[model samples]
Structure formats: C-alpha cells, structure tokens
Target: MTYHETVIIRAMNRSRFTVQQGQAVILAETADDRPLKEPLRDREGKIALSGLSLSELKQFMKSLGEPAFRADQIHSWIYAKWVKSFDEMTNLSADLRNKLNEVACLSALEIATLKVSRDGTRKYLFRLPDGKLVESVLMCFQDRDTLSACVSSQVGCAVGCTFCATGYLGFMRNLSAQEIVDQVLSIQRESGKRVANLVYMGQGEPLLNTEHVIDSIDTMIHSVGIGGRHITVSTSGIIPGIEQLRDENLPVTLALSLHAPDKQTREEVVPITRKYPIPELIKSLKQYVEKTKRRVTIEYVLLKDVTDSEEQARQLADLVRDLHCNINLIPYNPTFAEDGAALYDRPSRDAQVRFKRLAEGSGKTVTIRLERGTDIEAACGQLHNAYKE
Candidate 1:
C-alpha cells in the first residue's frame, strides 16, 4: 500500500493520530471502541465545566438536586470575588464544595511567567492546560485611572503582517472562550485591580475566530460584568468576519487594523489583504457603522520609510473619512528579524508628529498611540510565539 493509504488505515484504527515526517502514527485507541473502565482521559486536564455562565451554573446545580441559589454564590466567587480555589468560597456549604471539587474546576490558566514594565504595565504568560502558552498585558495609567488589559485571541496569528512577531509563528488553533476569559482574570488577579477596558489586540486576529471571540465577549459583558462599551475587538480586516460582527449588534467598539490604504501597499504589509481587498473591506466597514450606529476606529501602524509617507497618510485619511471612523496611529515597535540579521526600525519621532498632523488635518479625530512596555517586549504589536521556541 502507498504511504497515504497506510496512514489513513492507521488513523481509522487509532483515536489519536499525528502526522510527522510524511507518516501517520496511531497514538491512542478510539474512545468509542475502548472499554468503559478505560475511558479516554484528557491529559491536558482542560476544565470541562468551562464556559458556564451564572444562570447555567444555577441550572446545573438545580439539575443535580442542589439549591438553585448556589449558582449565584458560585458565580460571585468565580468572577466578582475572583477566588481561584473552590475551597476559598466560604459561603458555599462544605457538601457542595466537595461535590464541586469532584467535577468542576475554578481556574483555567496557570501563570507561568509575569513581567512588569517600568510604567506599571504588567505582562503575563499563561500556560494553558494543553501546554500552549499565551500572553496578556495590563496597562495602568495614573492620570486616567484606567486599567486596560490587552488579551490574546489565539496562541499565534495566521495573518502574516510583515512587521508583527506573532505572524512569524504562523497559525496554531483558535483559543476557546474559556481560554480567552482566563487571560483577563489571570492579569486582574496579578495586578489586584479591576480592568476598566479590554482590548482584543494582543496576539491574534479577533475576527478570524469569530464564534469563540463573540462568545468570550458575551461572557465578559454579561457574566463577568465588564461593560460592552469598554470592550474593543481589533481585526486585520477579515471581511466576512466583519459582516458577522455587524449581525451580532454587539455594543463593543470595532477597531480595524488598516496598516496600509491602497491594495498594493496593504497587501505588502498585511498578507490577508490579498484575499479581502480594500474595496470590499471598506464596504463592510461602512455597513457595520450603519448597522451598529457606532463609530469604528482604524488602527494604522506607522513603519518608517514603509507606510509613513505623506501620500499614504492622505490615502488613510480619505479612507476613514468615507467610513466616518477615527484613526489611531501606532508607531511600529522594533522587533528582531526572523534571521536575526537586523532589527525592524520604528517610525522616527518627527515622522510620527508629521503623520499625526496630516491625519488630524483631515477633520477626523486622530490619536497617536503612545508606546508602552517596550523594555519587556510588551508594547503594542510586539507579542510573538516565544513559548514554542
């Protein structure tokens, strides 16, 4: 038999299979065919009870012949009180606590590494149940009294933005709603502060994983009680996903990563622009504004000698003006080259000021995003797939 056929046969026999070196190897027996006593175990210890909202938790308790009020107690302990362990919930009866320990888990992410920026920005590296690692950042601004946490939607990104470190690792898998929510809680615990705003702009494209991303947002707003207005989902112009967001009628702000204006220029910086061109993307953004009646924010990363030209700035202004959106200019963060040859340079201070002037001159609200946590590689547009390496 051919190698391909051999692999399929082995995969059919095995429950767990992995393809390596152009060969398929069976790893474990199929769960359905296995004996009841030898049930397949999740080696990663993923919490099966994750994604349960407060109401659902109550329903589950009722189903188990327990008091319905216990659901509210558990929800308060898990989210409002931010308790990590089941035993710490002193309000719950000892019997219920023991029953919960037998089945459910309270926490999903285990903090493996934590780095604090000099400016009081905290970056956390969480080790997931499956050994996958993701990063989240909490930025504290004293003047604004704002604590915003930047959370990752995926372990690595598929949209290969030429300047992004996460793009180099390629796409892994979409993180579950639980994994996404855990990042916020993990950072909140470490900082001992409540997150005022949540941005889905950390490591991956939020729109690419539309379902889980929406579910996570739902949990944040309804279950976790973070205001929908305070949440922002940033995307690299996934057109279909943008359309999907419009249908949801979610109040969260939509931020488009419009790194470039024209198709040719954008395609050079953002590879996904080839698939979903600027014209279609613009149409979708306009539709979104009309549907939601909320202004969109365009995120333009200024790369020196790349997209920071006067002509590019004008093009960006015209594009946002047509859509009636605001512009957030982010100076590129210098990242090490894949080959370790040279570091990518950020926009010069003068160029940034000039670009800001051009953008603001277009009668649109424009803000130059200040770089934070560059010392620890925790600034905007700097997260990469480091745990894998």
Candidate 2:
C-alpha cells in the first residue's frame, strides 16, 4: 500500500524478490526455501541455484524430473569446484547441463578488476548481475599464516558511518546469499589459496541484510568448507542483529565497530548509534557473551585529535574494561569526506601506542592493526563504488 512497497512490487517483476524501503533493503526471511505467498525467483526469472541449500536443490531437481542425488553433484560442482557455468560441470550429462542452463546460473560476479597492494593484499571490484559494483579484499598474513577475506552484504551501505567510504554511496539492494558466498569463491579462484578466515566488514553493514548474510554463513560453513569459528561478523553496533546472531547459535566471532567512547561522540561517528544507544548495546553484548560463551572483539578506530585524545582513550578503556573482549586499535585510514575535505587524520604513532597501552592496562588483549592495500585505496573504510551515468 505504501510507496516503497509499491516500488518493491515493481522491482519483483524484474528480478528475485527483495524487501526494500526507498533505497534501504529490509530483511525478509525464508527458513527452508518453502513457498512464500510471493515466490522468490533469482535474477532474470531464473532460480539462482548457487544460493539453494542441498535439500532445496533436491526439491528443485525433483521438480525438474531429475534424481535427488543430482542436487549433490550440482552442489559439489558449484561450491567446491567453483564452476562459473553449467557448461563447466562436465560430470553432469549434457542433457541435464543444458536443462539447468535454461533455469539456473552458478554465481553473479562477472567483471572483476583486481588491485594488488605492496603488503600482499588483493582487492577486487566485482560487478553484480544488475551492474552494481561491490568490493572484497583478500589478505595473506603470512607471519600469522592466516589468509583472510572480507565480503560485502549489500551493494552500498545505509548506515552511513561518518568515516566509511561506502557510507557516501547511500543504500542499495542487498546481495543474495549466492553473491556473498561467491565473493570468497572468486577470491579463491583468483588467488589459488583457500581463505582461512572470513570477515563481513566490507562496503555495507552485514546485519542490515540479516537473512541473506546468515544464509551465506550457512553455505560457507556447510558447502564452502569454512569453519564458523574462523568467520567474524563485524557490526557497526546493531544491537538487534547482535541479539539475533546470538539466537542463531552460530560459532562465528562478533566484532563491534564501536568507533567512539561515549554517546555524543559515538552518534557523531556512527549515525546508527542514535537509534541503539551504547548502554543498551553493551547490555545486549553482555547477554550475547553470556549465551554464546565467546569473547567479543571491540573495534575502536583511532582518529587523530578526534578520537585519539588521552581522555577518550581512557574513557574507551574504562568503557569495555569489565567486558570480556579483546581490542583492535585501527589507526584511522585517511579518506576524504564526500565534500572532498580531509576531515579526519590517522593518530600519530605515539598516540596509538599510548592508547594501546591504556587498553592493555585494562587486562585486555590489544593490537594496533597493520593495515594493507592503503596505497591502492583498498584498505578498511576505503571501499566505494558508483556506475558512470
């Protein structure tokens, strides 16, 4: 009845069902891919087979007059083997592959632009089927023997954090579960290294697109062979999503993007903080830790003169002192604001050291993160996308 709903109805006519209000994509969930009153199709009237669970695939195969085990073969070929098209699924009979080609596609990201950093970081700009672009990064931390990848959940972010580059693009539609999983797969196919760790911290806020993000996690865990423990869901302090994640009972780590120490400063840094207050968020986080028995990661970005002062650092130390967590001190990555003004600066190295010391004094494990791909504009808070008109 509303204008946004009417617009969403119009969009459904062209592609898979997405819940949207203006440009902000809302979350609509399907527990087992059961029939909704409005059946969701994949883009272009096809069922994106890549996002389907094995059982759903079995149901689809049955509908197609194929054996149930065919789903198993297709699943293995798509997720494990990383095939782009049905034609590459050589094990399937030609007849079946041809039939699948009519109604299903493997994944979305087609046009990939790669950028390599001096620090052995690989950043990709991938074009979705709808021609929207999103970024994902792969970093090989050889010293720690960790291959970490970050994937986007939405085309652009709605949260609009003051310091993030993606925030400037406003909001767009959420990515399908297939799209989210394919990012990691694309990285693997491009780099020839299986990502040991994954983070949902690129482009958009993962929690805003909760359903697809969770489904992507399931696919990553069950099919793509990434352990849930190695997965980190970084939120810009979305309390409800944090609580929902706790209820999901997933083994993935939770990282809070608490950019500032207090309410006033936090609201200035992260606009969403006005909706979910810091106290309420901390309460929810405590409950999450209590329920999951997992230690949280507190992400505090050190902005020069703004969030780097001794008082704010001490306040940050006291704020999480009682909480069960480790701290990641991210020295601000320089990015020009939308007006093309340098409104923020990275904290001096001495300031970073002092902040780390204060956090460590709280008996918390703390590390000043070594950023990668900064020279190539691919580091944290540095990803943005727009299509030329």
Candidate 3:
C-alpha cells in the first residue's frame, strides 16, 4: 500500500466506536459460526449505521464473516443512495439484511417541529434519542439552496454569550460524529432537496468538540460530497480549536464569532473571551491564515447601541486588519421575554451604514447581512429549541 494509505489504515485500526442500541448484534466467526438470538450493543452504544466510515464499516462487516467489499457497498448505499434503512439495500442478501436490521439504525433524531418563514427560511427543532432538542436551518436562495444546517456540536452552549439564546440553556453533552452528519441527512429527507452548504454555527461551540467536528467534516466531504470550501465551521474564539484546525490542514472556511472588537465589550457579551481573550485569539488567527493560506471570516453581531458604534467598528477593523479575512455583520435578531420585551434592539439602518462604512474605510471587506427568517426566529442567536412537545 502507498504511504498515505498505510497511515490511514493505521488510524482506522486505532479508532474505536460503538453502534447505537436496539440493533441485532453480528456474530463472530467461531467453531459454530451461529448467530446470537439477542441484539448486541457496543460498549459505547449501538452504532448508527448511517455515519459509519468505510473503515469502520469494513471492521463491522468482518465480524459478521462478510467480505470486505460489502463495506464499500454499504457505504455507497448509505452516503450515495441516502438509504434510511437496511432493507433499502436491494443488492444485499435477504439473510444479511435481516442480520443488519437486528444490529443497526440509520438515524437517531426525531423531528419535533419545523417552522417555515415567508422568506423561504425553514427552522427545525429535532428531538434527540435522549429527549434533548437541537436546531438546524434551511435557507433557500434563487440561485442555490444553502441549508444552513446549523448543526450543534454540543446539545446546548457553554460559551454563555449574553446575546445568544442557546447560551442561556447552558451546556449539554457533545454530539457524536454520526449525530452531526445525521442532521443533514434528516433535513434533506424531510425537505426533498440536497443541502448545498453547511455551517457549524448552530447552537454549540464546534471547536470545543473538535474530534467529532473533524470526523463530521470527513463524512460531509467524502460521503455527502460537500466541498471543503463550502463548509464553514464557526467558533466563539476557542484558541485550541483554532490550532487544531490549522494542524489538521482541512480547507474548510473558519469563521470567528467575534461579536465585539474591544476586550471589555467582548467579555461583557462573550464570556469565553475572558479565557481566550481577543489579542491571543487574533494572534492565533493570523497563524491560521499563514498556515492554511485561506481567508477567514469575522462574524460580528451588530447590537443596537452596544456593538455597532463608530469607535467599535474602527476597533474591530483594526483587530482583524492584519489577518486575511472578511467581516460579516449580522444585525441583532432579538429573542423576546414572556413580558413582550426584546432582549436587544436591532441595529438601525443608519447605524449599520455607519459601521460598514467605517470598517470598509479601514481597507477591510465588510457586508451587512440581509435579514432572513428573523420573523420566524431562525436568525443568528435565535436557535434555542423553541418547540414544545
């Protein structure tokens, strides 16, 4: 085998995973070679068949005495054909299909609710196996459909950004790599459209859960056929995650959720800033640009009278000036309280114009994002499981 192939094989051999529960267990080849009567669960849990890598699937098939080629067939069925069940693999033998039915499942998310906006933005609240809710969004444009597919790395967020709704919910457990990949498949199945783009800017900090994020990236690129350039993984300034991304050498776009420019203003909103801090974060981002030779995006949420002032804009421009990056200014999409009060005012047209001009004047690329699904609460900082039972 080639050197790269040998390295990949070694990595695959080292990787350990479990199947999701309730699937029949594959019997090991023994003197009897008899199938077990009861279903088996992996030590971690039963593997959800949909997200298995080709390598993982090969290992699984081997335990069943199935030929190694069967793994490729299964991979094609799951990733290319988008099969939702083992029975869909018409080429597989009936006996093999029956064996798979006992031990594997396709997806773990149940669609709790879906809300569509007049502007063609659709928000989804998916109920997980553990009864926790995570959200994803589909945004349709005239030219192409960008399934924001805002996937969560963690159930809720630990960053606690004051403007974000998910932060208020606090942190839950991290999602498995398969769980992350399943979100896109589930959405595509429901919407009857292929996902054109993916953003890891949903509910949780992706960098904090880098391993699964990287695995999901692999599945999306190799299996789902999403281009590396089209996938954007946003982080709330997690320095370690940034370093990890740099080292991994993946070409996916990196977006820094830099809501505020100054350290004081940043800490007030994004609590994670106190730990990583803006200067250190910027320094790392510069190194990332040098290493990857890719332009990063600075995602700034424009809150009225808060982060949209002229001085803040200038400061923000200065902060990112040295780095090869563009700025995306998203206006505040407020989450209201029970008393009918908005958490933060949306930036005024004049304020947005002034901020954009100031940042652009400093020789930086800037864009004031047009609002989509704000009426449906599918905009930034608005995805926090708004569905009830």
Which ten residues in a row are the worst by lDDT in model 3?
35-44
User: Which numbered prediction scores highest in TM-score against the true structure?
Assistant: 3
- The lDDT values for all models are 0.77, 0.79, 0.80
Better of 1 and 3 by lDDT: 3
Clashing pairs for predicted structure model 3, backbone only? 19-45, 19-46, 19-47, 20-46, 20-47, 23-102, 23-103, 24-102, 24-103
Query: RMSD in angstroms, all models?
Result: 9.8, 7.4, 5.0
The residue-by-residue lDDT of candidate 1 on 129-194, one tens digit each, is: 777778899988877877889999998899989988888878887887768887887676666788
Candidate 1 — which residues are off by over 4 angstroms? 1-51
For all candidates, the clash counts are 0, 0, 9
Please, what are the lDDT tens digits per residue for candidate 3 over residues 68-113? 8998999888777777688889999999988776665666677899
What count of clashes does model 3 give? 9
User: On a 0 to 1 TM-score scale, where does candidate 1 land against the true structure?
Assistant: 0.86
User: What would the TM-score be for candidate 3 when compared with the true structure?
Assistant: 0.89
lDDT of 1: 0.77
Tell me, by lDDT, which candidate is best: 3
Q: Please report, as a residue range, the 10-residue window in candidate 1 with the lowest summed lDDT.
A: 35-44
The order of the candidates by TM-score, greatest first, is 3, 2, 1
lDDT of 2 by residue, 1-389 (tens): 44235334322322223322312121243444443422234456565666555655665676676787898999888667767778988888999887777766565565457888988998899887777899999987768776999999999899988888899889998987778887888787678788889999998999988877877787788778899899999999888899888877777899999989888889999999999999898889999999889999999998887788778878888888889999999998878865888758887899899988877777889999989889877788999863343
Q: Could you tell me every candidate's TM-score relative to the true structure?
A: 0.86, 0.87, 0.89
